[model samples]
Structures are given as structure tokens and as C-alpha cells.
Target: MKTLLLALLLLPIAAIGDDSRQLVKLPPAAQESLRQEMLDNLVAVNEVLTLMAEGKVKEAGEAAETKLGMAAMGKHRGKPVDARPGPHMPPAMHGIGMDGHRAVSEFAAVAKTGDRDKALALLPNLTSACVGCHFSYRTR
Candidate 1:
């Protein structure tokens, strides 16, 4: 009985981190597009990390800048959310997106300077922004 009660109490906590299509409530096409964008971003991040691992710091930084920086926003503009028939993102969600890009841009700048230690340290903070957003928002 004690263990069962404990499990029940922790259930919502577990679900909090597993939020899915419940928060954003977008159309199917828009949701899929968003998911695809997320996958693409993940791929870009992986490529940047690979380059960094190979000691190609400049190239890695360039990759991060091109893939996740301000330049990348142009490609996403009017495509992911604006031109697509969907509701506007809540301000909190919008802020999360901007914050994430800023973190990546800062990381790219650090990597560009060949400061491996500082760049690596920043990666965790960038990742934390991603995880926090995931935990706090979801799209259907």
C-alpha cells in the first residue's frame, strides 16, 4: 500500500517531463512540420558536435552558425509557423524558441574562438534549454 501510494504520487511528475501533443494544439501538418524541424535541428547539432570532436572547431562553429543561428531563422520564417495555417505560438513558447537560438549562437561564437572547454561547457546549457522547452510545451 505504501509503495503504491508513492508511485501514484510520483505519476504526475513523470508525465510532466513526457509532455507531448497536448500543449501547442496545432494542425496535423503543422505538427509534423515542427517535428521535422526538430529532427533537422538535432541533425545539425550532431554534425556540429562531430566536427568539434574531430578538432575542426572553426568548421564546427560555422556549421552551428549556419544551421541554428540568425541566418537559419530566415529559412524557418513564414514556413514553419507563419505561412502554415496554425495558431500563433504562446509568448512563453516563442520566448523559449528565441532563447534556444541565442544559446546556440553564443555557443557557436565560443567554438569559433577555439575555446574547446568553454564551448563544451555551454553545450549543456543549450541542451538544458531544449529539454526545458520540451518539458513545458507540446504540439498536436
Candidate 2:
């Protein structure tokens, strides 16, 4: 029974290893779209970091919210943008839908009043949701 249980657990691990070995095959257009999405998201996130560092927290929060919303909708150039696998994936971009919505809402509350400190304080929590999502899901 113990051996059977151990085998059952190891079976999924072996399957996952095999899956990882399989090359990720995407069409050229899809690959380009994925690359662009990653670049755009990185730019947006970097901008937010800059704003925060400059103590322009309100602006940062607003920009973050806007970028996050765009990411969540997955609409780039009138087409859908999907998440990319591996390091190309931005943690923040992975959190779409409800998670993104909540983060934006929180950021907005602090941003509306142009409160730099408050906005800065909210940034980590917002970023954390993104991190959580990325850790939980795998992109194709």
C-alpha cells in the first residue's frame, strides 16, 4: 500500500517532467504577441516603480491601475493577449480578472487623494496578488 501511494504521487511528477521537456509550440504571430505583451507589461511596471521612487505615488498608483486593467482584459491591438511562460512572464501581468480588479480598486482609493505615502503602502499588497497568481498558474 505504501509503495502504491508513493507511485501514485510520483506518477504526476514524472508526467509533469515530461510535459516540461516538450517544446512549447506557438505560431509566429502568437509568439510575437506574447513577446510584446511581456515588454509592455514590464515597461508599465517599471514606470510605476519609477513614480513610486520619485514620490509620485498617486500617479504611480493610477498608472498601475490602468496598466493592470489593460493586462486583465488581455486586449492588445484589438486581439487577445495571453500569458507567456518562463521568465518572460511579469508577475503583475499574470493577475487578471478579480485579482487585478481588487488591486486596482485599492490603488485607486489611495491614488484619488494624491497621497504618496498611502499609495506606496498599498503597492506591495497589490504586487503581492500578482506574485501569487504567477506562482499558481502555468502559461503555455
| Structural similarity to truth (TM-score) of each candidate | 0.75, 0.56
Q: Candidate 2: what lDDT?
A: 0.55
Please provide, for model 2 over 43-82, each residue's C-alpha lDDT reduced to its tens digit, 9 standing for 90 to 100.
Answer: 8778888988887877776787777543344354465443
lDDT agreement with native, every candidate: 0.67, 0.55
> Which regions in candidate 2 have their CA more than 4 angstroms from the true location?
1-32, 70-74, 80-97
Candidate 2: RMSD to truth: 9.6
Model 2 — which ten-residue stretch has the worst lDDT? 84-93
Candidate 2 local Cα displacement, residue 55, angstroms: 1.4
Residue clash pairs of candidate 2: none
